[model samples]
Target: MPSASRIAILGAGALGQQMAQHLRQQGRRVAGFFDDTCPSATTAEGRVLGPLAAVATEFAAGRFDELLLGIGYRHMARRQQVFDELRADGIPFGQFIHPSAFVDASVQLGPGVFISPGCVLDLNVTLAANVLLYTGCLVAHDTFIGAHSLLAPGVRLAGQVAVGERCFLGIGTTVIDSLALGADVRTGGGSVVTRNLPEPGTYVGVPARRLR
Candidate 1:
C-alpha cells in the first residue's frame, strides 16, 4: 500500500470529517481541508488550510501528496469539475477505506474511492473511480458500481446489481438482485427497488417508481 504523508480534503462537511478521521486513524497525515463555505473555520479534526482556489499552488508547492474529494452527491458536477481540473494538473487522487470495512480480496477498487466504516463488499464487486460507499452499506457479489456514484449509508445491493455513473442511492435503499440502473438515477431514502430502472430519473417509494 502506498502511504500518503500528507493529504488535502476538498470538503469539510460530515463526510469530509469522517474521511479525515479515517485517514488519521490509519497514521496518514491530514494536511488540511479546502472548502468554499468555511475557509477560515476550524473543526475538531483540523483547521481549514485554505479555499479551493489555493489547490493549484498548494499542489505545486508539494504541500500534499494526494487529494481526496470529500464533496457529497448533491455536488456531483462540481466534484467532477474539480477532479478533472486537478487531474489535468498532474495531481493524483487518493482512496480511503475505513479500517472496519470488509472488502473481499476479489473486489476491485479504483482511484478516489471512499468506503466508509462497517461497509461490506462481497466477492467480485467492482467499484469504479470516485465511487463513494457510506457507512454500513452492503454490496453483494458481482455487483458493479459505476464511476462517481454515491451509495448512501445503509444502502443494500443484491448480487449482480449494476448501478450507473453519477447515480445516488439514498440511505437505507434496497435494490433487488440482477437489477440495472441507468446513469444519473436517484433513489430516495428507504426505497425498495424491485425492478430494473433503465431511465435516468428520481425514484422513490417501496417499489421505486420513477418520479420524473
Candidate 2:
C-alpha cells in the first residue's frame, strides 16, 4: 500500500504481537488488532479493536491505513481465508520486511508478506501474497514461492525453484535448483528436497521422502 502507514493486524496471537513489535521497529504505527479470541482491550503491542468482522467498518471509518495477517502457519486455511476475504472486500495489506533482511532489486513480493530478520532474497525471487519467511532463510535467484506459503527459519532454496501455495517448509529445510513443490506440501525440519514434489503430503529426511 503506497499510501498506507498505519497497519492493522488480524489475529492477536503470538504472531500478531511479534508482527507489531517488528512494525514498531520499522517506524510504522500499528492501529491495533482484530481477533476473535482476544477481548477488545490493550494487548502488549496495541489494543484489540474487535472481531474480524469489524475490520471493514473500521477501515471505512479511517481507523487504519492497511492490514497485515498475523495468522500462523498451523492455520493456513484460516490465514488464507482471512486474507482473501479481506482483500476482496477492498482492504489493502501492508508487508513487513525486517531491517536486517536483504532483498535484491529484482525480487517481487505480494501483499501481506512478512520477511523476518537476516533473510536473503536474491534476484528475481517472487514471493506471493501472504508469504511468511522466518529468520535467516535464503532464497536464490528465480525462485517463486506461491501464495500463503510459510518458510521456517534457515530455509534455503536454490535457483529456479517453484514452491506451491499453502506450503510449509520447515526449519533448516533445503531445496535444490529447478525443482517444483506442489501445493499443500509440508516438509519436516532439516529435510533436503532434491527432486520435484508433485503431490501434497508431508516429507522428511536428507533426501526427502513422503511420510506414509
Candidate 3:
C-alpha cells in the first residue's frame, strides 16, 4: 500500500519476513503478522497478532488497515483460495511494489501483488491479483500475467505474452514475444520458451518441451 496504512501480513514465514523487510524499506508500517501457528509470538517483522481465523474479527475491530499474503509459490492453489475468500469476506488486500522496481504508469496491477527489487514492468503490462514477481524480473509491453502466478528471480517475458493462472516461471526462465501459456503451466530453471504453451504442464529445456 502506498499510503500510511498499517499492513498486516498473513503468515510469518520466510516470505513474510522478507516482505516485511521490503515494506519497511518503503517506510510502511507493519501492524503485525496473522499466523495460525504462532499466535502471541513476536518476530523481526512484527508480533503475531492471531490465527488466520481471527483476521475477520480483528479487521472489523480496526486492528489493521490492509492485508498482504506472504504465502509462497509452492502453495498456489492455497494462496488463490485464501486471497479470494478473504477478499469475498470484505478484507482489503494491499499491493507491495518495492521502491527499487520500475513499473510504468500504464501498467495495471491487481490486488495483493508483490513486486520485488529491480523488476521492470513496461508499458501496458497487466498483472492479475496475487501475482508475485521475485527479484530482477522483466516484463515487456502489453504482457498479461494471470492471477496467482509466480515468477522466480530474473525471469523474463517479452511483449504481448500471456501467462495463465497458477503458473510458475522458474529462475532465469525466458519467454519470447506473443506467447500464451495455459493455466497451471510451469517452467524449470533456465528454460527458454520460444512458442505458445497451450497445455498446462511442466516444461524444461532450451526450447521448452513439456516434461513427461
Candidate 4:
C-alpha cells in the first residue's frame, strides 16, 4: 500500500466516482472534485462527497498535489486539451491502479493512468501517461503502451509490442509479439494484429487491416 495522499478527480462520471470510492476504501484522502458541470452529492454508486467545485481554490492555491481525469471518452484531442491545460497549471497527476490488478515489480506506469480490475501487467511493461486499461486486459513483458491510449476489456498485448500514442484497442483484441502499432491507431473488437501497422486508421478482423 502507498502512503495516503490528497487527490481530486476531474470528472464525476462512473469512472471518476469508482476511483474515488476505491481510493477512499484504501485509506487515501479524496479532497474533492472539479467537474465542468456540478456533480451530485451522491455518485451513482452512492459514494457521498461534497460539491464538485470545492477544489477550485485548492487548485489555484497549489494545495493538492495529485489529480485524476475520470472521463471515459476516447477522443484524443479533448483528452490532450485537458492534459495540456493541467500541465500548464502545474498540477501533478498520479496513476490509479486497483488493488486487485497484478503488476510486476519491473513495470513502469506513467501519471494519470487507470488500471482496472483483473488486469495483469508483466515485467518491464511501460505505459505512458493517461492510459486506461479496462477490465481483464493483459499486457505482457517488454510492451510499450504510448500516452493517452485506451485498452478496452479483454485486450491483450504480447511481449515486445510497441503501441503508439492515442491508440485504442477494442474489446477482445490481441496484438502478437514484436508488432508495432503506429500513432493514432484504432483496432476493432476481436481483431488480431499480426503485422506492423504503420499508418493511423481503424483496423478490424483477424490479421488486422485498415478499413479506410
Candidate 5:
C-alpha cells in the first residue's frame, strides 16, 4: 500500500469536493483548496486557501507536492489557461484514478490526469498531462490522448486513434479505429467520429460532422 501524501486540490467546485473525498479515502491528506474567490464559510469543503495567483508561491514553498485540478468547465480556452499557469509554476500535478478503474500495465499516464470509476484503458495507451477520463470510458490499444483533453462518460476510442491537445469528447461519443482529431475540437454528446478531424470547432451527430 502507498503511504498517504499531502495534496492540494485546486478549485472548490463539486468535482473538487468529490476528489477530496476520494483522496481522503485513499489516506491522502488534503491541505484545503486553492481558489480565486472563497465560497461561503460553510462550503462542501471546509475552507479555501487563497487566490489563483498564490498557487505557484504556495507550491514552491513546499506547501503541497501534488495538485488535482477539479474544475470542470466547458470552455477549452479557460482550461488551457489553467493548465499553462500550473506548468509555469513548476508544481508537479497528481494523477487520480479511482480504485475501481482497470488500467493496463502497458498504459502510460501523465501527471494531473484523472480517471474516474469503471474506466478501462487497454495496452499501450498513452494519456498526456491533465487528461480526464470520466466513468465507463474506454481507450483501446495504441491510442494517444494529448494534453488537457477530456473524455466524458462512455466515450470510446478505437485502436490507433490520435486525439489532439485540448480536445473534448462528449458523453457516449465513439471514434472509429485509426481516426485523428485536431487540437481544440469539441464533440457533442453521443457523436460518432468516423473520419479524421483537422479544424478546430464544435462537432456533432452520428458520423461526427462539424457544427461550427
Candidate 6:
C-alpha cells in the first residue's frame, strides 16, 4: 500500500476532475489540483491549489503526500517531464485504481499506475510505473504494458501482448494476442493491431499500418 492516503492532482482538465472523483470514491482524500491555467480557482472536485511551481513548497509543508499526474496522452512529453521533475524533488506518486476496475491479485503493478472504471487486468499481467488504462480497457493474461504507456477507453490487448514505453493506444484500439509494439508507438482510434510493430510510429486501419 502507498504511504499517502491523500493525493494532489497535477492537472485540472476533464481527466483530472474525473480522477479526483474516482479517488474520493475510493475513500482517499483529494487535497486539490495543481494547474497553471486555473491557479487558485475552484473546480467541481476541489480547489485548484496553485501552479506546478508551488508543488515542492506545498509538499514540503505536508499539504499532500502524493501526486497523480492527470495530464492526457496528447501531452505525453510534458507528463514525463513533470514526473521527472517531481521525482527529483522527492515527491512520491500515487496509484489510482477505480472501484469498478478488476485487477487480478497476481498482476504486478508499479507505482503511479491508473486503472480507470470498468477496466480489467488479467492474471500475471504486468503494468509498469505510470501506465494509464482508461475506462473499459482490457489487458489479458501475461500482457506487459511498459512505463508511461496510455491505453485509451475500451482499448483491448489480447493475451501476452507487450506494449512498450510511452505508447498510446487510441480509443477502442485492439491488439491481437502475442504481439509486440515498440516504444512511442501511437495507434489511431479503433485500429486493430494484427502483428508485431517493432518500430515507433503512428498507426491506423483494420490491420494497423504505420502512418508516419
Could you give the C-alpha RMSD of every candidate to the true structure, in order shown? Answer: 1.7, 1.8, 1.4, 2.9, 1.8, 1.8
| Cα-lDDT of candidate 3 | 0.94
In Å, residue 91's CA in model 3 sits off its true spot by: 0.3
Off by over 4 Å in 5: 39-42
Off-target runs (Cα >4 Å) in candidate 6 are 1-4
Per-residue accuracy of model 6 over 1-212 as CA lDDT, tens digit each: 32346799999999899888888877788999999998999999999989999999999899998998899898887877888889888999988788788999999988789899999999899999888898999999999999888999999999999999889999999999999999999999999999999999999999999995
Task: Find the 10 residues in a row with the least total lDDT in model 5.
Answer: 37-46
**134 Cα displacement, candidate 5 (Å):** 1.1
Write the residue-wise lDDT of candidate 5 on 82-180 in tens digits.
Answer: 877888768778878788899999999998898888899999999998888888999999999998888888999999999999899999999999989
| Whole-model lDDT per candidate | 0.90, 0.93, 0.94, 0.82, 0.84, 0.91
Best by lDDT: 3
State the displacement of the C-alpha of residue 34, model 6, in Å, after optimal TM-score superposition.
Answer: 0.6
- Runs in model 2 with CA error above 4 Å? 1-4
Error of 5 at 106 (Å): 0.8
Error of 5 at 55 (Å): 1.2
Better of 4 and 5 by TM-score: 5
Please give the clash total of every predicted structure, in order. 0, 0, 0, 0, 0, 0
- With candidate 2 superimposed using the best TM-score fit, by how many Å does residue 6's alpha carbon deviate from the native? 0.4
Please list all clashing residue pairs in model 2, or write none if there are none. none
lDDT (Cα) of model 5: 0.84
lDDT of 6 at 76: 81
> Which 10 residues in a row give candidate 2 its minimum summed lDDT?
1-10
Q: Quickly count the clashes in candidate 2.
A: 0
My TM-score estimates for the predictions, one after another, are 0.93, 0.96, 0.96, 0.86, 0.92, 0.95
Q: What TM-score does structure 6 among the candidates reach?
A: 0.95
Winner on lDDT between 2 and 5 is 2
